[model samples]
Target chain A: MSRHLPIVAVTPFPAAAAHELKDAQLRANLGRATRTIRDKRARVVAEVPDWEELRERAARTKDEVLDRLPELLARFERAAAAAGASVHHAADAAAANAIVAELVRAQGADRVVKIKSMATQEIGLNEALAEAGITAIETDLAELIVQLADDTPSHILVPAIHYNRSQIREIFAARMPGFSAESDEPAVLAGAAREYLRRTFLSAEVAVCGANFAVAETGSLVIVESEGNGRMCLTLPGTLIAVVGVEKLLPRMADLGDFLRLLPRSSTGERMNPYTSVFTGVTPDDGPRRLHIVLLDNGRTKTAQDPVGRAALRCIRCSACLNVCPVYERTGGHAYGSVYPGPIGAILSPQLTGQDAGANSSLPFASTLCGACYDVCPVKIDIPEILVHLRQTGPKPAAERAAMATLSWVMRDRRRWRGALRAARTGAVPLRALTRRRGGTLRRAPWPVSAWTAHRDAPLPPPESFRDWWRRTHAE
Target chain B: MRIALLVTCLNEALFPRAGMAVVTVLERLGHTVAFPPEQTCCGQLHANTGYAAPARELERHTEAAFAGHDVIVTPSGSCAAHLRAHTELPVYELSELLVDVLGVTDVGARFPHRVTYHPTCHGLRMLRLGDRPQRLLRAVSGLELVDLPEPEQCCGFGGTFALKNPGVSGAMLADKCANAVSTGAEYLAAADNSCLAHIGGGLARRPGAPKPVHYAEILAGTGAAA
Candidate 1:
C-alpha cells in the first residue's frame, strides 16, 4: 500500500467513532459481545497460573523471530520445499495478490473455497480474484454472513461480531440460497450456514487459507479455528495456497507449546479449540496434491525498522485487547476503518501502512492510554507505550505545536507557572456565566476546550492554587 | 517522615481541595509534608500529545524541582506514574504513601457517607496500587465503602483524549457515571482528580448525583461521626 492511499483508515478515528457512538443498536451489540468475550477470557486466563510466564516466553520467541527474520524465512522455505511445498516471497500487497491470482488461474480454477484469513483480507486478495473474474466462497460462518450482507468484518476473531442474532438471521434470509428460517436462534442460523458451506467445501477444487504459525524447524504450518471449515478447506482440495505473514514464524517446532496454550485461552477462552490443524507439505494421495506458501511482507520490514513500533509484529490476532479496550467497546471495529481494528489495530495498522498512509494518523490518539490493552495483551506488546511513541513523531499542525511550546514554557519556572495560574483564575472571571450551571465548571468554551466541555464539564481554576495555599499556610 | 508534595497541575489549579486534603491527611498522621512551590506540571500531557521537545523541558523543570527529596508524593496516580519513570526521585501516590510507606491503613479520620472508589488507570495498572486506597477507606470508622461496578473501567478522561475525541469520551463517561450513581453513594472517591473532574462533570448533569471527593479528602475527614 502506498503512503498516499487511505489503506488504514478512510475517515479520521474521531469522526468515525463519533458516528459509531450514535448507533444505539451497534453500541448494544458491541457492549454485550465484548463483555461476554472479556469475561470468558478473564475466567480461562485466570485458570492458568503461568499466564505471565507464557506471555513472557511468547514475547521473547516473537522478538527472536523479528530479530532474525531473514534467516528463519530461509530455513522455513528450505524445510517446506523439502516436504514438496512451493514457497513464494511477496514484498507487498500487489505482488502477493498477483501471485495468488496467477496460481489459481494456472490451475484453471475460476472459483476457490476459502477459509477466513486476515492476510488475504489485508492484501485484498478476494477483490483481486474478483477482478480476475474468479469467485471465492467463504466457508467460515461469520465470514459468510459478512460476505452475504456485503459488509466488512469488524472484530478480528468474529468477522460479524457487530451483528446480533437477528441481524445474522436477516442476512441469511436475504443472501443465502433457499434460507427460509426466520427464527433468530443462533443454532438454527448456524445449521443453515453449515449445510450451504458443506456443499461448497465438497465441490471445491482449490482452497485458499492463512497460517497462524509457521514452524521454520519442521517446515510445517498451523491453523487454529473453532469451526472445522478450515480443516475441510485444508483436506478436500486438490490444490492449496496458504498466505503466511513473515512475522508468523517460530524458530522451532517445540516453541509451539507456549503459543498453543496461549492462543486458545486468550482468544476464544477455551481450553482447546475445536479444530487444531497442523500440516507439512503435500502428502502423496492424501490432503492436497500440490501446496504453495506465500510469505508476505506488506510493510513489516518498514515496521521492524523502528525499535519501539516493532513489537506490534508479535500479535497473534487473538482480539483480547479489543474486547478489554474501552474505546473499542464503545465504538466497535468499523470506527478504526481498517481490516484490523481496536487497540492492536490502532498500533499495527498505522505501523504496517505507515501513519501517513491513511487517516489513521489519528489512531495513536484513539486510546485514553488507560492501558487495559497492555494488561490483556497475550504477547506483551506494550501498546500504550508504542501509541505514545507514535504520537511523539510525524506531522503536527503548526498552531498546535506553537501552543504546546507556549504552554510548556509557561509551566517551566515557578514564577511563570504561578503567574499563569493567576492569569487563568482571573480569566475564569468573565467565563463564570458558562460555569454557573455546572457550578464552577464551564459547559462550553472555544475549539479544543469546547471539545472537553461538550461531553464533560470543564472545571474553572480556583481563586487560590495549591502552591498559593501552601505559601500562606506552611511555606515559611 | 518528611514528604515532598507533588500536587499535580490539575489539582494545584482547579481542584485545590484535593491537594489541601492530601496535606491535611499526611500532617494529621504526624508526618511533615513539604510543597516545593516551584513545582509545576509533570509533562505527562505534553509527552502524550506528541510535543517531545516541550515534554522534555517540563520533565527537566519537574526533576530539578523535586531533586534531593527522599520521597515524593502526589494525589494523582497518573502524575506519580510519570514521575516514577522520568525522574530519579522516588515517587508515590498518596494511598501508596499512607499504607505502604507508613504502614498505616487507618488515618484516624471518620466520614460516615457511603463512598465508592474509582481506581485511576495508572494506579491500577502502572503503579499496581491494588486495594491500598480501598484499605485506607475501609479503615474510616463511619464510612460505608461500596464498590463501583466494573471499577477497572476507565472514566475516559484520557487527558487530551477527552478533548480530542469528546464523543467517544463522553459515551465512556456516561457509562461510568451511571455505574457510580447506581451505587447510591454520597461521595465518589478516586486516586486522581483528573479522572474525578471528568467523572464529576458527567455526574454533575445528573440530579442528586454523589459529590466527587478524593480518597485523601475522605481520609482527612475530622467531623462528627454519622
Candidate 2:
C-alpha cells in the first residue's frame, strides 16, 4: 500500500467519493463555500485586464524552471549557502521528514510553531515530529481550527472551509484553554486564536514554514499569506526551517511580480495578500539566527521525467481548481484521501506517487474532465490533458479492460458495430416490461449498466437502429 | 449544402429520433443531409474512459465514414468536439453548423414549450461553443427559452463517468436537475444527446421532473411533431 507515502491515495477515489457523497453536511458546506469562492475569483480576475498575460508569464517562468531544474536548484543552493543558510536535499518523504525532525531535535526544541505548508503535510511532518515527542502548533486560524479538532484540511486555500462558524466556536470552546465564546463571529474567533498563538509564537524556539515561491538567483523564499500568521512564524522564532518543494522555484526575482498578482487572485480572490514574507537567510538582529531550507523532492524529479506529467509541477497550490471543480465541490478534499485534493490533486497526487502506486492509480479518473480547472489555472496547467494521460497509463481492472477490448474489436468494423447494435436491441427484449413501467426507460439492468441504473435510467433503443432506418428508407 | 450527418452511436442505437430531428432541421434549412452509416461513434466514450487506442480507431472509422464530405454535422456537441480533435474535417455541432456555417440562426422550427438550455461542458469549454447554441435556441419561433441557473456547470453525464463514479455523478446530476426544474421549464434542452440522456435519466427518477430533450428536437418540432 506504500503506507509511508503520505501523498499516495489511501482509498480509491470513487470509493472515497461515494462515502463522502453521503455526508450531506459536508456536501452542503462545501457547495456554498466553493460557489462563493468561484464567484469571487471570477469577479476579481475580471477586474484585471492582463490576467491572461500574467498567467502566461507565470507559466513560462515555471516552465523555464522545469527545463533547467538541476541547474536552478544548484544555483539556489549556492546562493542560499552564500547568504548564511544551510540547504538540505531530501529524496523522498521519509528522508524529508527525518531531515526536518533531526533539524528540529538539533535546535534543542520540543515545540515548534507552523505555517500551513503543503510540503510538510505531504511528508506527514507533524506526525513524524509527534513520534519524536515534539509538538507542532498550527498558527493559521483555519489551520488551527482543523488542528484542534484533529481534522484534516478540506480545502487548500481555506483548509477548514468544511466547518461552519459555530463549528469553529465549538472546537475552540473544547480545545482552547481559557476560552469562552461569546458568539460564532469571525472577529471573535480570530481574536481567540490570536490571543492563544501570540504567546506560542513568542516562546517557540523553532518554526517550520513553507515557501510559495523561491528565487534561484536571489536565494530568497517567499510566503504569500492572508492572515499574517505565517509572517509571525517567519520572524518571531530563533530558528526557522522552511520545507520547500523542489518545484517551487523561479529563475529570477523579477518573476515574483506576475506571481504576486496571480497567486492572491487565483487563490483567495484578493488582489493582494496581506503578508508576503521573503526570507533570504539569517539576519543578525531582525529575524531568526539559524536558517534551514529543506528542498524536498519526494516524487518531483520522477514526475518531471515524464513529458506529459511535467506540467503538473507548475501548480502553486492555489486551490482555485478545487473551488471550480464540480467533483471537488460535491465530495470536498477529504474524499481524495491524499495530501492534495481537487482537480490538481487528482492529476498531481497520482504522478507524485507514480501511476501504479496503490489507490493513487485511480486518482486520475477522479475527474469528469470538465476543464473548469484549466480555465481558472493561474499557471495554465493542462489538468485535463494530464488526467487523461494518467488514466491511460495507470492500471485498469481486468473486467473494464476486457470490456473496452471487446467493444474496440466490435467497433473496429462497420458490420460488427451494426451487429452489436442489433444485439443490444434484441438484448433489451426481456427488459421491455420493465421499460414499459418506467415510461420507455431502462431503470435497472445487468453488470456494465448496473451502477448507471442505480441512480439514473437508461434509454431503450428504438424499434430499429438509425442506420437501419436510413438504409431501408433510402436505397440509393 | 451537402451536410454529412454523424449521428453519434448513442443516438443511433437509443435515440434515433434525435438523428431524424437533425435531418429535419438541416433539410428545412435547404441543405441536403447524407447519413454516412459507416460512422457508429466518435470514440469520445473510449478516449474519456482511458482507451485511447480504441478511441483513435473509432476516429479513423468516423473519418473514413465521411471521407470526402466538406461539412460534417452532429446533434451532440461532445461527439462533434471529440471528432474534431483528431481530424481536420469541418466537424460542426448542430448549433455551429446552423449559426456559423449555414449563416442562419432560425432553423424555421418550433416546439411551443418552456425550455431551459444547458451548455454542456465540452461545448462550453472544449469547443468554446459559447452562446452559439443558446443564440440558436433563442431564435426558435415559439420556443420560450428560459434561463437556467449555472447553465455552464456540467450535467455530469461524462459517458462512463456516470457508472465509474455513480455517487458523485448522481449528486452532480441531482444538482443539475434541481437547477433545471427551478426554472419551471417543461423541457431541459441541450445540444448533446449523451448529456441529455444522463440528465433525462436523472430527471426521470424525479416525480415532477422536466422532460429532457435535445435542442435539435426542439428546433425540429414543427407543431405537428409535438
Candidate 3:
C-alpha cells in the first residue's frame, strides 16, 4: 500500500468553503454550468419512462458487484488475461503509478496521451510519470484546459467548471503557443485544443486511461465521454494502460445495457454520449497492440466492508450530485480539496482515505444533508444516509463529543430536558436584549453560537417554551 | 383518533405560535391534541451534526414518549422525517395529516394576502409532501398562493449546517429570499419554522421584504382582516 495519502485539504472544509465563497467569478461560473447541466439532465431524464426503475436496477447491480467483488475481480482478471491482455494488481496509489510509469518507460516513449480519468487523478499518476521523466498530455477538452492552466480539477465531469469561457480563452492564449487571443466561443476553443493535441495523439506510443466500467464476463472495458478524445486515446496508441478502480466492475457484459442508459442522461444530460469506446484485451492488427489493466484497491475494500457507506462505491462519477448540491453550487469544487468533489466527494473521499486522514475527516460534515444529491443520484446512493454513517464512524472533536454525551443524558429524561430547556431560556435573556434592537433577532452571537448568527439573524428563545405553556394552560 | 402534537424543539422555543396554530387548527377540526411532555426533540440536530449516540438516545426518548398515540402530527416536515426515519411511529407533517389522513384539502381558514410557499427540502424530497400544503392553501378563502421560483431549492437552514457552513447556507438563503421577494408576496410560508427562521432572518435584513409565516399560522386564520 502507498504510505503517501492522496492530496487532502490542509485547511478544513469550513475555512476552505469560506475562502471559495469570496470569489464571485468562480461562483458565477459554477452556478451557470451546474444549472445548465442540471436542467439538461432533468429534461433528458424525464424522457425515460422507466428512469426510476433504471435507477433501482443500477443500485441493485452495483450492490451485487460489491457483494461479490473478490470473485468478480478474479473472473475479470482471468477473462482479461485470456483475451491477450496483461493484468496487474495494485494494492495502492504508489504501486499503480509505478506499474504505469514502468510500462511507459519500457515502450521507449517519453510522451503519452491520456483520456480524462478520475482513477489516474486519484493516484497522482501524471506527477508520478513526470517523476519518471515522461510527459503525459490530457486530451479531453475539460481535462486539457485544466492541465494547460496547471490547475487542480474541481468538478469530476467538468474539471475546469470553475472557469468561464473568457477565462478559458485567457488560459489558452497565455499557455498554448500560436493561439488566438480574441476568440472566446466554445467551439473556437475546442477547435484550438483539437489542433493543439492532434499531433500528440498521432505520434504518441502509449496512452494512459481510466475505465468507467470493467465487465467481468467479457473482459471488456468501457470509456464513456462527450468528446471523441477518449476514443482517440483508446485507439491510436501502440500500448494502452488502463488504471481502473475495482468498484467499477460489473458482473457481466449485459449489465452494461442499464448503465449505458443511466450514465449519459445522468452525466452530460445527453441521451447518449458522443463516444463510448469498449475494447477487449488487444486487437490483432487494429487499435493498441498491447493492453495493460491495473486494478487498484486503495481503501475500496474497507469502504465496501461498511454496510451503510458501501453504497458510495456505486457512484459512476456522473456529477449529478455536484450540480444539485447547494453547498457545492456556492463554494465550488476547490473547497472539497479532493479529486472527487461535491456530495459524492463528501462521502467518497473520506472513506477512500479513511476519516483520520487529516482534513479529509471534515468532508462528511460539508453538506447541509438537504438530500438533493440523493434525489438526483442515478444509482440511488442515498448519500445523506452514507454521510451520517460516515459521521458516526469518523473522528469527532472532543468538545462536541463531550457536549453530546451531556445532552444525551439530559434528553433521555423529560424532567432533565425541561430543566435544560429552562436553563437555555434563562441563558438567552442577554441574547434577547441584544436582538431587541433588531426586532427580536440576534445578528451576531458569541463563540459556539456565533457560527449561526454570523450570517443570518437568529430568533430569540420565547419567554415560555411550549412545555411551560402546556403546563400553565392545562394544569387544571 | 388519538393525535399527539410533536411541536419540534425549534417551534417550541422560538416560534410557539406555529405550534399553537397547529393546535388551534386541529381543535377547530374537532380533534383533541395531546401534548406528550416527555417528548423533547427528534434528535435531528444531534444526528445531523455527527453525534449518533445522543441522537439515538433522543430517538428512544421520543419513541417512548409518544408510544401509544394513534397518530403523531408535527408542524415541521423535517422533524417528522427524522422521527419517521429513526422511530417506528406513524408521524405525519401537518399537511399530510390534514390532507392524507383527514381527507380535507380545505381546512376552513382564510388569510387575505399574497403568499408564496417555499417547499423546505425535507418536506419536498424526503417526505414527498407534494402539493399537500399548496392544495390546503388554495382552499383557504381569499388567499393568493403565488408560485415561488425554484421552490424546490433548500433554504439552507440544514440544522447545524447553517452554523458550520454559514457562508454557503447564507448564499442559499439569499437566493431563496430573492425568489420569495420576486413573487411580490406579502408573506412567505413553509412547513418548517427552521427554514422560515433562516429565510425570515435574511428577509428582515432587506427593508420592505415579505415577512416569513409558518403555513399552520395561515391555516389557523379565520377570514380575519389585518
The candidate that wins on DockQ is 1
Give DockQ for candidates 1 onward, in order. Answer: 0.81, 0.76, 0.72
Chain B, model 3, TM-score against the native? Answer: 0.97
**TM-score for each model:** 0.97, 0.97, 0.97
Candidate 1 chain A vs. true chain A: TM-score?
0.97
Model 2 DockQ vs. reference:
0.76
The 0-to-1 C-alpha lDDT of every candidate, in the order given, reads: 0.89, 0.87, 0.88
Model 3 chain A worst lDDT run, 10 consecutive residues: A1-10
Comparing 1 and 2 on lDDT, the stronger one: 1
lDDT score of residue A238 within candidate 2:
87
Q: Give the C-alpha lDDT of model 3.
A: 0.88
What local lDDT does model 1 show for residue A240?
A: 98
Tens-digit per-residue lDDT, A30-72, candidate 3: 8899999999999999999999999999999999999999999
